[model samples]
Target: MRYLAAYGGENNVKAGMLHYFMYPSNDISVMPKEFLEERNATNHSNIGEKTLKKSIDIYWELYKVKGRLQ
Candidate 1:
């Protein structure tokens, strides 16, 4: 398991978000060009798309509210 405590915002979250999604456990093989561009205004990673959608889906399922709220 891994934990991250980072500020929210485009700039503040980019590097951390990238690292999270690219972590070996996540198995993310590609990343959206726009995302990498926004990360550093350059697309040197040469990764592809569907990364955002995949990451969001994983996040939603991982952090989804389960059972009844207390």
Candidate 2:
């Protein structure tokens, strides 16, 4: 709590920067890019397309911002 306060006083909760302390699955292997691509192509489409697209957009934006900062 003290350390987090040093960062920004905890008044602001930034998305994509701070994640839950514990995640349901810590294994990244379960959601590989190829697997997501294949699932997205399938008829049923395991995950919702809109949700996946939004996540991808967020990643791209973060990447761009990081590159610019450096």
Candidate 3:
């Protein structure tokens, strides 16, 4: 999302390209076996939750700034 904002929001061509590159369809198929195993093991871990919360907080901050500008 930050990348999208940096490239001029979701509607921009560069943002679309960035999204495609960042989230390729073959991501899981190409991942290392050990990394996949570790991710599966930590599927329900607190780290994932914390990371998600942090991302939301950042987006919220950006949203507030946008609102103020408007």
Candidate 4:
């Protein structure tokens, strides 16, 4: 919990940064330029409540899958 404080603001709750973290290292060279442009264009604050609900569903699925891995 203390570590999450470093990211600040809603970042601790935001899935966008988590998607980046789970992506293969920060090797922009490996990612397509168009994908990078799209990532940069994302406006998290403007995201609708439905998206957040979907994210929660994804989080639960990921949690279940991760538990199965062990």
Candidate 5:
């Protein structure tokens, strides 16, 4: 949590927390639809597709869950 937020902009902290909690395997799939939608719309450039991909990888590793994050 702290590591991911280390390089994040101050204003992005809230979004980062939401991102971590909303990641797949949290058993809250439908809950974060709006957050994901908003994030895709707003942070595409800031976080970028590559970063999101990396996030997916990290999520899998962190939770030890299988399947795709997309």
Candidate 6:
């Protein structure tokens, strides 16, 4: 979390957090639909999509969840 916030803009990081909520924070899916609608709005360019995608690709092998940060 620290590393992500340090590298990814904090706001975008939160967006990612919500996107990956299935990890544990997935309860966010229950939030108002209006909020969930923002899911496609985040773009954490500083976090490097290449690296982020790689990490997620690996994690996706073990866990099947939905949502994209950008």
Query: RMSD of each candidate?
Result: 11.5, 14.5, 9.9, 9.2, 13.8, 13.5
TM-score of each: 0.27, 0.29, 0.27, 0.28, 0.31, 0.28
Candidate 5 per-residue lDDT over residues 1-70, each given as its tens digit: 4423342543344355446444533233333556656554232135655676566566535743235355
What TM-score would you give candidate 3 relative to the actual structure? 0.27
**Which candidate would rank higher by lDDT, 1 or 3?**
3
Residue 7, candidate 1: Cα error in Å is 19
User: Residues 1-70, candidate 3, lDDT per residue (tens digit)?
Assistant: 4333445543353434334334443342234566656654222223454565555456556653345664
After superposition, candidate 5 runs with Cα above 4 Å error: 1-29, 32-45, 66-70
Ranking by lDDT: 6, 5, 4, 3, 1, 2
User: What ordering of candidates by TM-score runs from best to worst?
Assistant: 5, 2, 6, 4, 3, 1
When summed lDDT is taken over every stretch of 10 residues in candidate 2, the lowest stretch is 15-24
How much lDDT does each candidate structure score? Answer: 0.43, 0.37, 0.44, 0.45, 0.45, 0.46
Off by over 4 Å in 3: 1-47, 65-70
Error of 2 at 45 (Å): 6.9
Error of 4 at 18 (Å): 15
* 17-61 per-residue lDDT for model 1 (tens digits): 565444522233234556555553322232533675466457645
Worst 10-residue stretch by lDDT in candidate 4? 1-10
Top TM-score prediction, candidate number: 5
- What are the runs in model 6 whose C-alpha is more than 4 Å off? 1-32, 37-43, 65-70
Best by the lDDT measure: 6
* Cα distance off (Å), candidate 2, residue 20: 27
User: Scored by Cα lDDT, where does model 5 land?
Assistant: 0.45
Model 4, residue 17: distance off in Å is: 14
Off by over 4 Å in 4: 1-44, 65-70
Q: In candidate 4, how many Å is residue 5 off?
A: 16
Tens digits of per-residue lDDT for model 4, 16-45: 344443442434223456776666533333
lDDT digits (tens) for residues 1-70 of candidate 2: 2223333432222321232111222232234566656653223333555665565456545544334654
The superposed Cα distance between candidate 4 and the true structure at residue 46, in angstroms, equals 2.1
